[model samples]
Target chain A: MAADKVFKNRIRRKLIQIAAFGFTNCHAGNFITGKLYNGKFKEFCTPGLNCYSCPAATVSCPIGSLLAVTGRADLKVSFYVWGFLLAIGAVLGRAVCGFLCPFGLIQDLLGAIPVHKFRLPKILTYVKYAVLALMVIIIPTVLILATGRTAPLYCKYICPAGMLEGAIPLLLTHESLRDSASVLFWVKLAILLAVIAGSVFVRRFFCKIGCPLGAIYGLLNKVSLYHLTVDRDKCIDCGKCAGCCPMDVDPVKAPRSAECIRCGACKAVCPKGAITIGFGSGRKAAKREGLVDMNVYSRK
Target chain B: MNKRKVIGIVILIAGIALIAAGVFRGELDVILRKAAVVCMECIGLG
Candidate 1:
């Protein structure tokens, strides 16, 4: 794709992200009234980490909904939320993070501020998996089983989206709702600030190291319908794609790496136009052309 | 279809079926009950 086309896609993605946020938080009237929407749509889970406690949020967040069901005394699995997430992941993997997440948009906006940028280490990318396993799943379930007390552990302790969307605005408007303020609120506020600061330097900082939801989507990225492919035949060893990848994915080596959010920045910057990303299999085409795996620049 | 494609399709189908079953089992109600209420913890209240 040409640079101009990439520019158009970038604009289109931003528009889509805005549209997604607006659609999920459709009850704009709730912001003024400072009340959550308690409609039938609340039964359904949104792909992003939208807070149900958010005044304008019409849909339940997938992670929260999952915990709500899973942390029950009966400990029954949440089929609906699970299936919905699986379907979404299977279709496009972490592309949802690229094109739909409201928080991703927030990070992108924050990243636009002119500053000395720093690269977040690849070792830290594995941290989100721990968040999913521990904060989102293991810790909550264990507490519920042991003490018979349930809580949205990740949302309570670490979710910056909740603070931004549900806590801040509601707290500003509903003075009565401020009674719960304590050390926890202060801690959460501090976490939100830290996350915000991190995003200013590293793109999608929370997604890389904090978001349990992204971890789930990342796990399914290998089998997702859409894939990122590099044509070895196009043959210039320039590392432009890897250089442009916000997620630090080496497209030539691991086109379908779990860390890849399918942002398409890599494909856009490839000067040889060697990359094609969509529903079709890039590996099969390479194999059909008798091209082996890209092992030249790839680390063992 | 190849093994990966087949596996993906099977998972997709199984997912849709499970979701439909969840709805029938009133799991949607479970989600609704939790979502409709103003969650204190989610808002960083407690």
Candidate 2:
């Protein structure tokens, strides 16, 4: 990828992120009036983690909606949200995180603040899986079975996106709501602040450590329709792609690694142009490039 | 298509079917009701 191409990609990504944020949050009037959009559009979910409670949001966060609907003792799990998420993940994988998530955009902007950014420790990167297993899955299931009740614990306790997108806007506009702020709000605010600070120092701290949604999408990265391929026959074992990867993925080594966000940074930096990303079925892109997909899934 | 491609298509079909079933079950209303209102839990309240 040449410098101009990289610049173009970056610009394109930023514009898309901004456009997505606007598209998802287009009910701007709701923000001024401090009211949520109760339109039929709320039935669907944005692919990224935009909060349904956000006044401007036209759709729901699938993770939040899943936990809320599933946690209820009376209702069966709403397969709609799950299916929507699954369909998106199957096609796009973590590309949703890279391109569509409003929260990801916030983190990316924070990461651009002329400051040193550290790659998350590999051990810490696995925390999101544990979070998904525990908070999103096991705990909710256990609570429902034991007490006949469950809650969206992740959104309530740990999701900084919910806090920033849903809570802050509501609180700012509604004095009565602000007056009712509790210890829980303070605690969540503290967590949100910590997450923001962490993002400043470490890229995608929340996505790498706390986002169950990211974990779920990452699981499908290998099989997703849109993905990256590294042409093995292009030669050169250069480590540039790995060095530039925001998610700490070594595209040459693990092109389909669960940690990859498919942001195209690696592809943008690949000197040999061995990387190809976007929508394609199976290894068709690899075959077209006259290269083996480097058997990336086998090694690391 | 290869196995991976087949698998992807299958999963996609399954997903769409599940969504349609959910809609038929009126789960769309459930999501709309939950999402249309201000959620207290999301705001760190009851």
User: Best by lDDT, which number?
Assistant: 2
lDDT tens digits, residue span A165-254, model 2 = 899999989888887688989999999999999999888889888889899899888788788876665637889889888888898888
lDDT of 1 at A108: 84
For model 1, how does the per-residue alpha-carbon lDDT over A131-180 read when each residue is reduced to its tens digit? 99998778887788788877888888888999999999888889997887
Worst 10 residues of 2 chain A by lDDT: A291-300
Estimate the TM-score of every prediction.
0.91, 0.93
Error of 1 at A297 (Å): 21
Candidates' C-alpha lDDT: 0.82, 0.83
Off by over 4 Å in 2: A281-300
Query: B1-46 in candidate 2: lDDT tens per residue?
Result: 5566677677788889889988888877778888999988865655
Q: Which of the numbered candidates is closest to the native, going by highest TM-score?
A: 2
In model 1, state the lDDT of residue A276: 69
TM-score of chain B of 2: 0.88
